[model samples]
Target: MNLEHFDAIYQRAAERKGGELALESMLSTPLTQQELLSITDDRWLSAFSMKVFQSGMSWKVVRNKWPNFEELFFGFKIGPLLMLSDEQWEAKSIDKRIIRHHSKVMSIAANAQMIYEAGIKHGSFAQMVAQWPSDDITGLWLYLKKHGQRLGGNTGPYALRQMGVDTFILSQDVEAYLRSYKIIEGGRDTKRSLAQCNQAFSFWQQQSGRSLTHISQIIAFSCGDNRM
Candidate 1:
């Protein structure tokens, strides 16, 4: 399908945000591949767990209690986390220091196992993420969804973005923009729809010479009522 040039979208976003300078200031840059590589496995698990807990909950509350999560989970060290006994996990589910959600509490260990296996296969989970091609970020997202718990939909993508992986979040505004342009059709979570989005973002990246993160923000800013 044909798509509008990235310049036109940027112009609209710039107008909405006040000016080109203001729009540029609002866009965020993803970390470099080397920077992503330098991060350890534990940190990746921490990011994943945070996103999982933050889902359908107050981010501020999760952030406030994050230190306790780190302490209780042994800083999310993969080795120790993978070894927790059933009774130990049960105790953590009711711990007052955390949000007390049993299912989400269980996801921590499940995701840790996913990361541990990825580490064994790819030298480290960070290496696998660092080496993933930015052009095919959906593939990485699919991998997480298949291997980890509660990592489907935006959860996996959000976690990857938080951990410095170059990815575009399919937020409400972004989805609306894609549908308006006819760049995607039907269910947003379907593989076909995601592939369409990947193609559209790839085209925009080529036209703008920008990262997926920036392009995503531009699309969001260009639409909806986010005017500044």
Candidate 2:
């Protein structure tokens, strides 16, 4: 129930691994609210599309093919992406320029609309994402899943973190640590499990005044893994 217990675990793991945890080295890269709020629309779309294409696929493959994706999607410009006709997107299925997952390719349009609408309402899409309470990050995750295409489960949180938002990513190692503490029970991917983990993180955040990213990184380090 104490965050110090979690810190002890991370320290032991770091000692065993013969180096500081990744989070330790990231001290200078703290993600601030102002930084997140300043992110541009293109970056938001790129981050979202990266997470979407990365789902259930090799990250290396996605990275390798990203330049082509950028070209095909017009650098993920929201306006051009929205203006792309259905036939244009359908043609991408057969085009060698990008991954041919039909549903994922189609998601670009749906997600574009999601961002566009948010921008219309909030002055900018970044405002919407940046203004979300980091203490209730799961709420933002729910909104992304409900509003954006192909952004269910881990995609939203992963994308948000990549966009420099202060949020936890429930990776396997993080989930394993949560279970080890009995904070969550059963399989790690269930709604109930996530709720339990979120509550624990919320409590710990209040106590420690740490960002969710740092806390999640500490948990993963405690497990002696950092694949996320």
Against the true structure, what is each candidate's TM-score?
0.97, 0.88
Segments in model 2 whose C-alpha atoms lie over 4 Å from true places: 1-4, 19-23, 26-30, 186-192
lDDT of 2: 0.79
True-vs-predicted CA distance for residue 27, candidate 2, Å = 6.7
For all candidates, the clash counts are 0, 0
Which residue pairs does candidate 2 place in steric collision? none
Best by lDDT: 1
What are the runs in model 1 whose C-alpha is more than 4 Å off? none
Per-residue lDDT tens digits of candidate 1, residues 1-228? 779899999999999989999999998789998999899989988999999999999889999999999999999999998888999999999999988999999999999999899999999998899999888899999999999999998999999888777899888888888898887788888889889988989999999899999999899999986431
lDDT (10s digit) by residue, model 2, range 144-210: 9899998987898888888778888888887667767777787665677667777888877776577
Q: Evaluate all candidate structures by whole-model CA lDDT and list the values in order.
A: 0.91, 0.79
